[model samples]
Target: MQANSLDDLAAGLARNRIAGLVADLRLDGLHSKAEAAAVQTAALDAYADDFAGYVLVGTSELSRRGLGLSSPIFAPLADRALFGDGWRIHLPQGMIGAQCELAFTLGRAYPERGESIDRHSAADAILACQPAIGLLGRRVRPGTESELAAIADFALHVATVCGPLVEPADKDSLDRAVMTARIDGKTVVTAKAGTILGHPLEALVWLAQKLARHNRQLNAGDVVTIGSCAPILQVLPGQHLTVEFEMIGTASCWFD
Candidate 1:
């Protein structure tokens, strides 16, 4: 093996040892749990998504980490990119579900890899808003998981499905956009554009600050999905769902 590859492997093994030891320690106290979780996140940073220039993340309260993004990002996730083409959507069978969210495709890259930016500046960096579905799945054993570990685990992320793009709107006007979802030809969920932490731009701004802490940044061609506008809905096999960002565009996906 190449020297660097071997070094990475060795480092991953070491990080896993440290995280596993911490995970197995007594964790009833708040500080203990948080400490272990922080270790896990560090291990995750050491190992996952080591190849990509950057990874996508969510900015929603739906995240258990309370960080607005899934635990497992920066990995080779299965998210697919396409327009609002309903035909291309697919979901894992069983308990896998979907969360409708507003995602952005960046046109402008940030100045530094890890530098904080405010909501207004973050908004200026967005190229377009795309209808998005944050695919959800969980595999961690219940008693063994902590919020920090969950974040380290890519926030229990499955994949992200994106639909067609809509031109950016002034924050105030965009706030009025209506959004809805239909499952199996029946409307099951509804919401408004403002539902995402009051505004999707806020999510982006939040992500920027978090990434800056880690010495990371959102760049051009990267996807930044905000939180769901409403509670996530369980999708059944053979179900077709369409999420329309009124006055913006309609994006579709399905369970198979």
Candidate 2:
């Protein structure tokens, strides 16, 4: 049993020290509720360090601990790269998604439980805007519903790409705003900002609140990828993809 709490673990991870510990757990293939709590705590602490925390745990982690395993592997957390303001990962097999959505550059440290800030309050805090991607990969050889193994395998976060700057607006009719992704000049996926969470700003709100729970806040100059607007698009080597949004702007990438 770990004497430390989830908050402690979160802080450790936020500081990048948890990587070694996470590696050790992965090597041992141990999974226990105590360990999971410790990891979550470490994650929360890590978020506190950066002032940007993750409130949600992937579903796989929850189920594994429920089954009483020791040291289950963890998903490659996205916050790590986000905290560094720069990092890259190779996309895993069966993991390809080209999403179009608004990317938020915050204006201030989004408070967790203080006076809640409205959508307009968020608009003024914008630093830069670029289309963003979450880069998700599934567990290798996914099990049938409950027989899932580990989330550590799914920890391969490809990349998070954001552009320079774009205009910030109230964005009430985000769903009406159309965004598209093109590959090699061919349209691949098209959707609206509303696809993110009814409204793009909602993603901002979700991000703000979620971060707060982990004792982290989105401060000014943090780039927040709201979520995906389109379905995952498989890519091949040398594929050129361009994503265009409504009021936000555009970003491009080349797959090797």
Q: Which candidate is the best by TM-score?
A: 1
Error of 2 at 237 (Å): 1.8
* TM-scores for every candidate against the unseen true structure: 0.69, 0.62
Residue lDDT tens for model 2, 126-158:
555567554543322333112122222222233
**Alpha carbon lDDT of each predicted model:** 0.55, 0.48
Clashes within 3 Å, all models in order: 10, 25
Q: Which ten residues in a row have the lowest lDDT in candidate 1?
A: 21-30
User: Which pairs clash in the backbone of model 1?
Assistant: 60-68, 70-155, 71-151, 71-154, 71-155, 72-153, 72-154, 72-155, 83-164, 84-164
lDDT of 1 at 155: 47
Looking at model 1, residue 66 earns an lDDT score of: 39
Q: What is the C-alpha RMSD, rounded to one decimal, of candidate 1?
A: 7.1
Misplaced by over 4 Å in model 1 are: 1-84, 87-90, 93-96, 111-116, 141-145
CA lDDT, candidate 2, residue 42? 45
Give candidate 1's error at residue 234 in angstroms: 0.8
